[model samples]
Target chain A: MGVAPRPPAGDEGLSALRRLLLQPEQRRIEELGERLDDPRLRARDVGRVLPEALRLSATESETGESLSEALAPTVETIIHDAVRRDGRRFADALYPVIGPAIRKAMAETLRQMLQSLNEVLEHSFSRQGLMWRLEAWRSGRPFAEVVLLHSLEFRVEQVFLIHRESGILLRHLSAPDVAFEDADLVSAMLTAIQDFMHDSFSSAGRQPLDGIQMGDLTLWVEQGPEAVIAGAIRGTPPEALRGVFRRALEAIHQTQAAALREFHGDPAAFETAEVQHILEGCLQARYRERPRRTSPLLIVLLLALLIGSGYWGFLVLREQQAFEAYRERLDRAPGIVVTQAVADGDGYRIEGLRDPLAVEPRSLLGDAPLPVERLRFRFEPYQALVPAFVLTRARRLLQPPPTVDLTLDGGVLRLRGSAPAAWVEEARRLALALPGVTALDDGALQDPARAELQSLRADLGRQVIHFGVDTPRGEIDTPSLTRLADDLRRLQALAQSLGLTPQVTLVGHSDASGTPARNRALSGQRAQWLRRQLLELGVDPALLAVRAAGSDEPASDAQTPQGRAKNRRVTLDVRLDGAGGETP
Target chain B: MRKKVCLLGAFAVGKTSLVERFVKSLFNARYQTSLGVKIDKKSLVIDDQPLELILWDLAGEDEFVSLRLPYLRGAAGLLLVVDGTRPETLDTALMLHEKALDEVGEVPFVLLINKADLAESWHIDPRDIDRLVARGWSVLETSAKTGHGVEEAFVTLGKEMLGAE
Candidate 1:
């Protein structure tokens, strides 16, 4: 609103000249001012410039400091301001996402704890573990350490260090026995698998694979910022081995930091002997062998020895019993004098004296027959005049006739033969009264007198004489009479030798033509004539007797003349007193 | 010193006969196929070094079964035998060689073309032998019957194994 002051002529001239020179610059400033004054245009300008600044900041966060460290304080302040404004909403929004995740983490931790506990229990109760415990006690070592050493026997067969970005094998260490010809291939494969897992399953924030197990070998992988370490373990390693891997990775990062961070494809930078020495410290190959137990073969041998000895004892007892029974049998035999009866090997040897007349000792075993091979006899002859010997002597002294026989058995004497009556009576009385004789069996013995009588009757029957006619006085032929007398005398002499009284009887018979009274009287007269003839032959009167027979006692047919002459003959009958006696 | 060697081949390739010819110098006219594995030991001195070779004769590979890998655990060398009369046995022998390399890493080995006694009826082609030779594989023509190149095959494998160690 106020009026302007006028310039000097010289200043006015300078101002005109300056105004003409700054005219284009003033117009450009005016245009820029107008565009900056529009809100949409200003927003477009900011949009164009903000991305470069954000990218620069992101690059600084990634390459310089970690993202967590760069954003931690800012995020903390923002979270505090948000919580103050809407704590309930913040909690509600966070619960659905974080609750399950926290629970899953807790569950995984508890599951790992329980798994470790179960493994400890299984190892403590196992047979191999028990032996290990015993060995721990014997060696004065801690039980837990022994269990760790025995149950988790581990051998670090091979170890590899590979660059994470290029999948190049940085360093390799292997046991002398383990061969790793394709270690680079294995590293590449491992890196490829890790990339595949990261692509397939890695979420916003998750770790890559850490381990892989195949049969008895386990590959333990530890990843760092630029390098990865993989170890091939032969057996089950303790969980504490992870610490060793971490320590190795940390050492590699400290010593080979520049090589790991700015690594190309060259593995020579990491192949230093110092790195190998540091990695070798992680290797642990500890093994605890179980103690040997008692063998079962020794126990079986002891039992077999016991059984064998018992069987031998039983055989000895049986042999002793057999010998005892043999001794008892020898004591009961009377005729044998046993001098020696002993067991010799499998049999018995017996030496004694025996009597020839007595029963043999071998015969005494009738009730109990022993095996012939098990018995041996050696005896000498002896004269033991026992009861049997006395009986035999008595039989010989009797001396009976040739028809007599004697038998002595079981103390009984028997006579079984034919003899004279006197001889039989003598044998019976002598055998019954003999010493050592229990009984006499003479019932079978017979006298020969009865047999002699039968012979005498046959001789007298052939010498019968008959009258020639029916006359009371028959003709006595001298030669015929002499023969008849000789036969009668022989019969009488047989009876006398038999110690018997002989008696002769004469009988007369008549024909039917004569009268009964006259025939009877004539037969009586013929009997008296025959009796006198026998008396004249020097026979005893007591042995001569006569009998008369009438026509009722016919000798032949009575109607003929020869019959009448035969009927008138005199018949002689002889009898011996003792010889004709009943057999005694 | 002692070394363990494994014998691998197809069925009826006469792996046992090769061992008998080398160890006992005896041959049986009758063929008795082996079951599972049989172990035999032979002692020899090569270059003034005493060596005890433990030979593990594994069962031949059939259509229904294959060789067990556990039998090749600590082997230092391998003897791959193929019947000269059967060309298919060479395929089995090569396959087994691959498997053995996978399990035991790189080890010295020798390939034997067995039954050279019947050369007229041989089915193995000369080109196959030439191909193996070109690939730096040692191939020997041996016969358990006529006792040809039997000792050289074992001795060569022994020397290579000793040198490798």
Candidate 2:
């Protein structure tokens, strides 16, 4: 009780914190390995090795060891050569510029890798499993989000305080901070010492004196030798400190940079926003490296792939159409003709036959004499079901009917009563030749009396009108005001020839050179000019009306010379007086 | 600082046409309706100082009326157009001028009487033109179809835009 308790040995606690800090390198390597494992990573060469190399070199440098000690001799040589080329004494020396480069390279590599990985993963995780896994991961509680909250504030006092503790600062800080902060010259040495201690403890992987020991803190706490170093880095001279801090970042972040490659997949599709977002998000989360989904570039690349696939699908559809056409041709011989038998030499003239000699006989015509001369003919199986007859003349045989009618209501053939059995058979054959002719109808076999009466009525009303009148001046006529009026009247008569009576109205048109108002006046005068001529022609004045359409309605286009000439014409319309009346 | 001038007027009164004429010195016969405001720039020497003029050719449609005032931000002058043959354009021109004043405070504006090449059929009176001039507004008759008085109109406005009286 009497012995005074010595303050708990402070050096031992500091040493233990140092060990804890060093352990992060190993943890970082493991984290990096997970990121590289994604199958899709394309920069396999770069992504897999760079991050691990950076971590190993940085760790070795912290302990004042060679890269060879942390990794195999082969990997050590690579890191050694890279640092040597960078003109740095050690791998840790290249941290600043190289850290960012490594990170970017890893990101690119990982993005490329994802494309191949997706195929394997898609199959591995059944569709449902993949969907559910994505949902679950998204739904999972977010990791303790560590955001690098940057707040720039002007504090003259903070600078003054460091200046007042000038000697203490320089002894512990670096030369850059001394120069940057404009501290007293003597303070440079003191600040330099503090800077050394800070970097040394961090480099040694020791938790800063002020660092939080708790696993999780409700509020983020940035306190420790690390924080002090950060402050020093901020306060240091922009010129000198820039290099030092940059180097420190490179050293600390090398492993992360190398691991970045695991995330890259499809380097070409890496320009999308999603890929950028993923890289930014992972970096912000301080993930040892990003996963494929976290990479925004990969997402963009995936979108591009989908779009490419859609375009390929369109091409596939076009190919299918071409194939369908090709398939259809292959199933049938080219240019084959089929026809009903009639009595004109071969009895049936070929209709629209590319080659009349390519016709083939059907199975139903078993043992029937195969015609040596392959006269093109349409043989329909349904036509065979209907009775067929050979219509012959003693002297000259007429051409075959274009089509043999086989009208069927359901699955049965209705024939005219007068139809001979041969005609019924021909109808069945014709019906069968055409697709969708499942059944046949030989209406000729319905009733001979009914057939005779129907035929008579059909022939009774069939008539065609042929015109034989000739106009006086068959020479070409320009569409002047006079000729336009005469044509209008002539067209009206043409409509009458087709059994339609028209309400003839004469309209006049003109060119655009004249003033609109004057043009309107001129149009009316032209229309009046036509009205007088029509009256002189002894045309019914009561039936004829005239109006100035102006330049609104052009028969031909007005932009071109020919179009304008055609446009300057009168159009005649025939209006049937009754609803059911016919107009030609 | 460049002065932002908005060319606001009725549908075919030639806002784009006028701007195109001033900027490119070429006229296009085929006219298509402008969808939104287009920005064009030109600089003029006034009193030995280079004054940059940013002309915002505002689309002239009834639907665009709501968006007109926003484009007028930081504006120094407004070019209001009226079809010379259509005396009806005078009312539309006056309405636009009044809105510029009400929304953007006091700003100098010039009235462009466009389509002057067409024969005067709507009975535009000399006194009506003078009335616009009397109300502190400058007026110029121009034809976007031709180059008549087009340059003079912009040159006069350029003086007012550069704050050189």
DockQ of each: 0.01, 0.01
- Which lDDT tens digits does candidate 2 get at residues A1-584? 89865557656767688768877886888778865786555466677788887776676646534354345557868877876687556656656779899999999898668854663354335564355455546867221111111121111111211111111111122321123432322132223333334444567665533211222211111222211122222211223332433343333234223322322111223333433332222111111222434334446667999999999888766644543343233235433333323323532223333232232433223333333244343433221222211111100121223333333444344433354345455555764444334555554454332343334323221211111111111122234434544544554554444344556555656555456676566556665555675576655675567676666765556687656555444333333332466322
Candidate 1 chain A weakest lDDT stretch, 10 residues: A290-299
Return the top candidate by TM-score: 1
- Candidate 1, residues A418-450: lDDT per residue as tens digits? 778777767767776666678877787766766
Kindly list the per-residue Cα lDDT of model 2 for residues B48-118, writing each as its tens digit: 76655556666674544433454554456778878777676687777777787886667667788887788
Candidate 2: TM-score of chain A is 0.17
Residue A90 lDDT, candidate 1, scale 0-100 = 96
What TM-score would you report for chain A in candidate 1? 0.32
**CAPRI verdict on model 2?**
incorrect
Candidate 2 at residue A493, lDDT?
52
In model 1, the Cα lDDT at residue A73 comes to 72
